[model samples]
Target: MRKTMLPVFTVIFFALGWALFSLSNTTVSQIQPRTLTLATTTSTVDSGLLDRLNPVFEEKFNAQVHMLSLGTGAALRTAENGDADVVLVHARSAEDAFIEAGFGINRRDVMFNDFIVVGPSNDPANIHNLESASEAFTRIAQTQSLFVSRGDQSGTHQKEQVVWATANINPQGNWHLSVGQGMGNTLLQSSELGAYTISDRGTWLALKDRLNLEVLIEGPVKGGDLILLNPYGVIAVNPAHHSDRDYELAMAYIGFLTSIEAQQMIDDFRIDDEPLFFADALNEQPNFEQYVPQSR
Candidate 1:
């Protein structure tokens, strides 16, 4: 009888242990925060916009937002590879291409800040007060002034390429420096070299105090260069293409960004009295076709 009792006791103890372990696991699972991955441009991160914005979203949703800040091209590629749940970037043509390629969906215009040509205070290219970015590029090339390019396929880099193309000059030679770096580093390099470079206004406002560079050509907001208008978009990775992603959360994030509260936050966010980004989601009517691929 005693041996039988001992066996029963051992069985009960094992069962109890298993039950507790299961309960513990269930509790952990219930308490675990849902994580959403965001692949975005360095400008957003560098300008401290995300620092102000992400925390609000994270707290509101009780979720964790893991950010992968890179150049716009790299950010899009990250989503293309299914590593990110969503993307926030400024390159419209590339964003259109991503949607057309079926890697992303439901792209919504989120914000706008124009690109500015920044260079030494001396304005070696004599590009100061230029109303056209293309003309500025032409001057830079013609003078063979040191031009620092992001070269990393960032939105700023894409804009620079367009300007160079507009100027009809294939930039090369020692005067043209292609630094495959982020916006901040590229600006720092440009400052160090006293070379002219294009940067988004947000980043320029955020970092101009620390650098010796000054805005040579302002974007449309402050100047007449409409080509420098930089608009940002947010898109979710196509859930059908990658089912493992947090599509619901991605959409929720997009909703939050476009929401009135968030838009106000974007509008109110500034650095030293200079607004970093202007919220555009509410100001413009949604182009239904722009949300999806044109073919669809």
Candidate 2:
């Protein structure tokens, strides 16, 4: 009995030491506090853009910019509620409204990738050759082609709203289906259903290899009458909302986003030989510092 008791006691001591070792490691990990939460859209997150960008940004900033990827609506809500330090989203109208509501500041157009209507390879809606996005929607509405909607108040959904408004049509009856999810999931659903759907060019491009759908209509080409121009923007939350948030840090990130290095990164952010986004930080308005710094 004494021998057994002694061996059991020795085992307990070894277990205690191992527990302390793990505890010390966890405590060490918690000491740095090198984390920042970025609320951003699903398209960017789902396409693993953040993963590609994070290493550079984190090494430069000496901190991790962990992302909470959601739809634009959900991300804005997170920013508004002070649940995140910064937000990267694309919906222009909603973003303007958010800033006007005193929830955000420093709106900077980071980059752009337009929305597109995708359908099965067969093109059952007969919208294959339509030059006008609105006309395509009108025809789809008329024919009642199965249309998959993100359904969530996402940037893609907002664009769809505008397109529907332009076509003077309402997505009613059995014609439209709302997936109420992120871009990747919705694309999968659209593929499975072989339906027509509007999606961000970035997400679609990233998932192109995996999906059987093809782009049916391109939104608002340059010099076109289309209203759906999907320009992504980065915004810092109002300091008044969360005094504890590192406002300066958020600003610095915005600065990086608009900087020449980051613009170059954005310009190079491509997949499968198709550029996911066009850096518009300097294209719309010529800022020498944005595209070409004085040092360069």
Candidate 3:
């Protein structure tokens, strides 16, 4: 009886050892590399573009994506600090500055969508039907109509400053409200106050259903007027700045973004059957200088 019990104990010990070894191997095999950090604008997150595209990237590369959604300015800053692996942002001037400062590398055009001035349907400032954003802004300033500004130093905010500068009006007063928030929040503030605000067409379209705001300036597409072309670019954080930077994964994301399939997905992204962003990866580089205001 003692001999039989000894063999049984030995078999049980061997079985437990085998089970532990298999479990250890499985855990090691399941362990993936560090998550790819993508710092991007709220517009992309708010519009659900990232949600649709990121999963495809993860599946293709066998990687995990950790998205940091912020204003473009904050996104760039995050990349600059080496806290992010890559950045997807608008504001070409800011992008150029980031690359010039050596915080980013291999910048590539990803996509574009124009900005629009959205306001109450009643059009308190009567900026509706205006061909020029500068002219519309001038009217808003003159009327002292309620205007909500993102004022968050985001790409949208930077573009808004350019519009104001073009109009040659220094916006100040009770009517001009500066909320240091994101595009979505700013739009909600504008809607709540029945004020006017500039917004990326994508976010505007996505949120328009629930808001009382109407597109006062329908960008170049509807032909009302301003060439408020908002182009987006993706840049990998320079590995020189951060030793742990996932440069390979960053390039993979860039490649995926510029691929024909991804570009088609961008073109297909729409709200209420209206396309949000136009694919530009296959298009020639646009003359961004023309969009920049010349110094007076």
Candidate 4:
């Protein structure tokens, strides 16, 4: 009876020690910072800019960044639903709408990259050397050339619509293909179909090697074409809408992104020695109020 009792006591002591160890570990884990959810556009993720920048943010803050890469519209929707802590998108009009709707706050300019019309190397629509994007779109529609549209309502898609409106052409027919996909997929589709599509310069440069398309129109060609200026902004999801949002972490991320170090990193990001995104946080911030609709 004494020996049996001795073994039982030893087992109970070990079990109690194990339970205390687990409890302590759980307490530590619970006290540790949680992950940050960032809903951003696909261009940033697909172009590998986030991959290059997120690690520094994570390390500095001791928190993991869970990226929900989607179109600017979808990303804003996610933030509106209180599913994301922050967002990085490019469509100025849409961003203005979001801010006015009270879904986001602290909008800041992060970077700028122009949009370009890319198509087959042969230039079927004879759009090559065309200074105006609207003229190029008109030509594409007039010729009924295969033109791919990212019907996903992404930032790129929004810009495409603006160009179409500028051209005064409601593109339709079999020639205008609305693929309802992201920039990378749309670009791939365009390449496969040998069609024309609009793409941000950064994504194009990053994925150009794998694609057969060539840039049909680019900016600074001795004429003013500000229509292609694609600027990216970072906005924190309003915590008032979602009580669980990690507002502090989101602001930390914003600071990290807008910091001088991160700005330099943005300027340094390149593909094949050519810079991808130009740093704009240090420069003049865009007056998005002008883009805001009067109805708001």
Tens-digit lDDT track of model 3 for 159-236: 999999989999999999999998888988898999999999888887887898988887875665555878888989
lDDT of each: 0.89, 0.82, 0.87, 0.88
Question: Which stretches of candidate 1 lie above 4 Å from their native place?
Answer: 1-31, 287-296
Q: State TM-scores per candidate.
A: 0.86, 0.84, 0.85, 0.84
Residue-wise C-alpha lDDT for candidate 2, range 1-296, written one tens digit per residue: 45558788889999999999998788447657467789998888876667877767777877778799889999999989988889999888888888878888877778877888889998877988877888988988888888999899998999899889988888897879977988888999999899989888778887888998998777653333356578888889889978877787788788888788888988887688667777778665554432221233
* Model 1: how far residue 11 lies from native, Å: 35
Q: Which candidate is the best by lDDT?
A: 1
Once superposed on the true structure, which residue ranges of model 4 sit more than 4 Å away at CA?
1-31, 220-224, 284-296
- Error (Å) of candidate 3 at residue 137 is 0.3
lDDT (10s digit) by residue, model 4, range 204-271: 88789899999888853223367988888899988998879998999999899989999999999888
Give lDDT: candidate 4, residue 295: 61
Task: Residues 101-135, candidate 1: write the lDDT tens digits.
Answer: 88999899898989989999998889987788899
- Pairs that collide in candidate 4 are none
